[model samples]
Target: MLGRRAFLKLFGGSLFGLMALGGYAFGYEPVIRLDVTRYALTPPGWTPGLKLRIVALADFHACEPWMSAERIGSICAHANGLGGDIIVLLGDYTSGTDLITGKVGHRAWAEQLATLRAPLGVHAIVGNHDWWHDAAAQRSGRGPTFSHRALSGVGIEVYSNRSVRLEKDGHGFWLAGIEDQLALRRSIRWKRPFTQGLEDIGGTLAQITDDAPVILLAHEPDVFPAVPSRVSLTLSGHTHGGQVRIFGWSPYSPSRYGDRYVYGHIVEEDRHIIVSGGLGCSIMPVRFGVPPEIVVIDVG
Candidate 1:
């Protein structure tokens, strides 16, 4: 029903638009865009008169051309200027996908991350990819994974089912980190396939001796449901904003909850969770509406 010239013009425009989107997703966003997303909240039961600024970096799937050591160093430098009281590293330091042209070694990325600074300290927790990529840890079916050793070697305290109390301005609170929830690949048992997790939420929470408000650092947002209201806030990475979110909805998410826990700040039943879009690519080197990000949170 259309003239030849009109139809050709419409087709050409659509094709060009597709090409531009592909280029942006594959080349520009993943390689060059680094966003700093900030959130401010007063969690329930938070100590009065205590204000804390948290700078968090996550999912540095370090690999050549995508996330180089120099780039990570630059990110750390930027984070240092943010005047955060504490810095937290949410996991996936290893390359998460085989699409990399060259793999960045653990030490290279770890050394760059060591440059991160905060008045309180820099704490870390490993991700699923960190465990999956560590052959020795996978073989033994236990941790200290290679990622853990590298982060520790760089003077970063990697928390595994651990809780530590931190104070600021004479106000005290507990920071708890649980181990990866998908650390091991298990064989199918009785016609069902399930991965084994190293996370011990109960054990970690038990370490908190006082009634101080707790802030939990979990690598994957999928654990949010099990988190009790005792935890004031839960910070997480690993969904990577579904890796290609559009219109605040991710078409594909690795989380079992799909778009429910795919990205950003979420609150349910008076509990709060902030999931970082993260700083690297996983599964593939492509990004759309959800660009790589450094997340900052201000809590009172």
Candidate 2:
């Protein structure tokens, strides 16, 4: 029932409103997500008397020009301060393949990560990236500047996927580290294969009384398939929980073995599997649905 002039005025106002809203709708927006999950589980062999808390960090592609030394040091300090009795660093230390050739990028990368620390000891296992880099370290002449010694210098204990016993608070638990599923390459030159020298899940755990708890630290969650049922809990940080899961699903994870292993926690066949969305960036310097995380897990 409005007159022509009034109709035009109303149309102009409505059009202006739509235009303003549409501008924001098409704005450039980078997607970002942060998820924090607190998991509490009763492992098959957890003892009633002792409590063990471990902070896990992984997939820190600490290559130069990305993760600076100061930044790496800060993250390490933060992980150690989580008040957990133990801290673990899963590998993917650098991205360059020049370690064997002794290059600047490799050296700088290792030196930075050596800064990370923990109280119960910062234990670690190599990822495929670690294995790939080792090939570089094995190079001759102007070999790359990085070395496994870099981690040792900073007091980080790199564990070959094998089990070791720990006595804490008068009670003892076994901390088992496994060579990555990609251990095939690491075994070619090393004295013994990862699956060898290390206790098979059954044998490695045979000596530990049923009452003692076990914490398995591996670089990738794929190890879960081969891990024995005895390990109370397994901590891993590859796949970054899919790094970019949408609606609770990750689009892709570079788990050499399979993309089925994204990131986050999984319980299969009585094993508590926790995969962390590591602290640093990788090939595609971006994380959408999955933000990097430092988990403080408490077990009693």
Candidate 3:
């Protein structure tokens, strides 16, 4: 019913818009940005006049169309250049969907992470995806999860509901990590063979000195609420900063507690939690509004 010229004009404009959006999602947003957000924490045991830098990278989700092995290597190489005192990885190493297996890629990625130089140490913990995939693998006789093998192979200690000390000049604080939130609950729900002492936060804290300031690594931010006041700081990444934020806020964050602690630094009374926007996408390869990031927190 319209003239040919007008119809062609409208069609051209729509095509251009779709192309631009595709470029943003597949090309620019994922590859161009690797934000290094900084935060200052005032933990009770933080050394007066002494500063410590901790670098946290979460939700690598290594696979094709999102994060490749080379991309993961480059990310770690960049983090190494930052010269952080401690490097902590907050899990979700592989994608949940089967678009990419990520087995070989993960191994290569771990090798690159091994080269990281941190004064204190490098530590990591499992996320829900890791547990989920691992569970699936076990059923098929694929043996234990690649996470334990790859991460530990590089000397990056992986902790599950346990605490360890990071010493510098004989002065230090306690760092603890818990298993994936859903995995812990799933074990109870299915009444399957449960791992003893899994996610026993109280038991983990018991190992540390009463006065020692604790830094907890919990992959999912939902665990933030249960973390005690004794835990001075907690590092987490699971919501992916909502992945697709609108109006500087997201309505679809994957959390039981909603977007309260979706991303960046959050202070609850005396406790502090820093959730990274994360370095990779989940479910879909597209990321809008929220880009990949590596968070750096300095405490003193």
Among these predictions, the greatest TM-score belongs to 1
For all predictions, the C-alpha RMSD in Å is: 1.9, 8.0, 3.5
Residue ranges of candidate 1 with Cα displaced over 4 Å: 187-193
Report the candidate with higher lDDT, 1 versus 3: 1
Where is the poorest 10-residue window by lDDT in model 1?
185-194
How does candidate 2 fare on TM-score? 0.72
Q: Give the Cα error of residue 57 in candidate 3, in Å.
A: 0.9
Q: Rate the local accuracy (lDDT) of all candidates.
A: 0.92, 0.63, 0.79
Please, what are the lDDT tens digits per residue for candidate 2 over residues 1-300?
A: 999999999999999987764443222111122233556666777887787777777876764434555556666666656676877777777652222222235456566656655556767666656555655433331222243456666666776636678878888888877655553342445533342222145554555654567888777677678777777888887676665567987667666555555666677777788888776565565555566677777788
lDDT of 3 by residue, 212-262 (tens): 568899988887888888888999998889888877898688886788999
* Segments in model 3 whose C-alpha atoms lie over 4 Å from true places: 1-11, 100-105, 136-144, 184-197
User: What local lDDT does model 2 show for residue 18?
Assistant: 78
For model 1, residues 21-136, the per-residue Cα lDDT tens digits are 99999999988998899999999999899999999998999998899999999999999999999999999999887898898999999999999989999999999999988777
Q: Following a full C-alpha superposition, what root-mean-square deviation does model 3 have from the true structure?
A: 3.5
Per TM-score, what order, best first?
A: 1, 3, 2
The candidate maximizing lDDT is: 1
TM-score per candidate, in order? 0.96, 0.72, 0.87
